[model samples]
Target: MDPGTNVLDLSQLRRSCSSCALSELCLPAGIGNDDLERLDTAVRDKRTLDRGGMLYRDGDPFEALYVVRSGSLKTFVLDDSGDVQILGFHLPGEIIGFDALASNQHVSQAEALERSSICELPYARLQQVTSEVPALHRQLMRVISREVIEEHRHLVMMGRQQAQEQLAIFLKSLADRYQRLQRDSTALTLSMSRYDIANYLGLVVETVSRLFSRLEEMGVLEVNRKSVRICRPDLLAELCRSSGVPASKRRDAG
Candidate 1:
């Protein structure tokens, strides 16, 4: 948890992370062992962020691209009207600050939604490593491609989906992500608050609360304070497609 501490042992870190649930999505699929080791060396810090902590703010110097080792993060932007628009949520094994790679300043703010750990790879060092490690460059390309795809999905969700439909798709998406981490996909503990969800969904808190009640009453979800269980995933998916709710809205609803 200490930013100053060497929280990861290099040899063990490489071995442990190589088999991590996210490895297939993260590392270069066909990377050689030596390249993997080189990539590991680029990681400079393993820092822990507590709930409500700011990982980095807009205009903060872009130093490193962080990989979520555990827990969840929310990225958002504040408008001139003082309203916060949630951009996206990052889960374990996902990369943060990818947008910064193309610009000198960060495009948005990243904050911890729960106690989280991230591995930081200094940008300059990573660039240097990539120059010498072809596999690393390929891996970086894949990461960027994934980001683009996710962004495209968000844009579609925002433009097309309705509130209830969006919420259903969001729950299913979160459940899929949890399943990847070997967690229970049906039941989830929400680290982000209802107010945050409302802001992200572009709805009032009352609307968000009402949606939860409606879904619960319909036997589609089991809702508790900051916790949820999807009782009918198939039905939820149908709602997402039929209602055309934005994915971000659904994700925030729970």
Candidate 2:
């Protein structure tokens, strides 16, 4: 074996998935160690976005999916009325740009809520790796599926759930996502501001503030500025489960 070839392989080996803290959340459970190297190779670029930076703008040509290696982002669109419509929030271990895969052009803009690192998975390379690795393909599908499910959850929240229920579901969902990344689920910092949350949840800023105050009074949670501590997750869960939207209605909408 050539010594130079051995050295190059060692360099690639050092970039394996085990080095990523969010690997367990991003990759499927059964991926082979060898597949991790393939993934690392497919990740062609690492880009940093400062707070308020746009990852990709509406109508930008999209040739890759970006995974949030660190930081947070919000995907939004400007409606015909020139109003900003919040789509969703992205956290570490979550992948964005899946929407652009269908049309090859982004319909919404992804903006960083804070300074963040992103891993770019070029479409061509991702397809090549997915073709070679069944687990990789499945993992990508699962991530896309979760995004779809989350969208539906948001729709249900807005369409029928009360303001309190909507807030509960949102908080509970955020907690669950953080837990998946091995973070403290009960304690979290809101990267997206209150204004953004209100926009996304279809509530006015004052209404959002009132609802948070109500929840705090209920002793279900504590909120100080952007820091949230879930004092009673059980109570929060109950509120989410009792969302005014019935199961039959959800199924029919689907």
Candidate 3:
């Protein structure tokens, strides 16, 4: 299907909660057949966004949670100086909109980094469905917990690691995430620009550009514009370890 704004009817689509490849990583995980059907029904709409399209702005009402069905998105906020501070990048099977859960309004903006398809789960219906499905509720809790852990890990990485170590950990973490999704862990097509990557890593754009070239020189990565092939993830991991980052938290450092 072409990527556009029309809302997709899940009933007519080939992909749904039960049939989705991302079922194990998303809310549908651990749900029973009947509960899955109910949870699927709670997904009221699926929408497409063009690259650079705004999914939701900061302060928008928290009405639904979005699950990336295809493509990627980046969430960010404007700092006091009005500079954009990237919070995270969302890949397929990853959920966004959790930023609104606490305040009932989004604190950051989510924008499509590429043509993307997203499933919208209305929060009210989700709460009702989760109330009835114990397994689903547990899964939701687990997902939220993981989000918290990821944020904490990112904070630690930013504060403790040097520039090269930060970049290495970030690439290594992205590779690991792809591997978890059953994709090639060594290759990646970065949807977010170098500027976004720099902002997320708390570095200047030039620093990020220089670091990529450095990694390429070290034979740890093969960088071709936005495309990157991790030639030595082991070397990347070692960089993180040498920076005193624990092995267990290395995968989530990005």
TM-score to native of every candidate shown:
0.84, 0.89, 0.89
The prediction achieving the highest TM-score against the true structure is 2
Question: Which one wins on lDDT?
Answer: 2
Q: List clash counts for every candidate, in order.
A: 7, 0, 0
Runs in model 2 lying further than 4 Å from the true structure: 1-15, 243-254
The residue pairs found clashing in candidate 1 are 157-246, 161-244, 161-245, 162-244, 162-245, 166-245, 167-250
Across 1-254, the per-residue lDDT of candidate 2 in tens digits comes to 87676554554444456677778888888888788878888886578999999999999998899989999999999988999999999999999997788888999999999999998888998999999999889989999999999999989888854887888889999999999888999998999989999999999999999988988887888998889999988888878888554344456889
Candidate lDDT (C-alpha), each: 0.79, 0.87, 0.86
**164-229, model 1: which lDDT tens digit per residue?**
765665677778888877789989888888878777666788877889998888788898898898
Per-residue CA lDDT of model 3 for 191-212, tens digit only, reads 9999998989999999999989
**TM-score: model 1 vs. ground truth:** 0.84
Candidate 3 similarity to native, TM-score: 0.89
Q: What lDDT score is found at residue 204 in candidate 2?
A: 92
Query: Arrange candidates by lDDT, highest first: which order?
Result: 2, 3, 1
Error of 3 at 110 (Å): 0.4
RMSD of 2: 5.6
Comparing candidate 2 with candidate 3, which one achieves the higher TM-score?
2
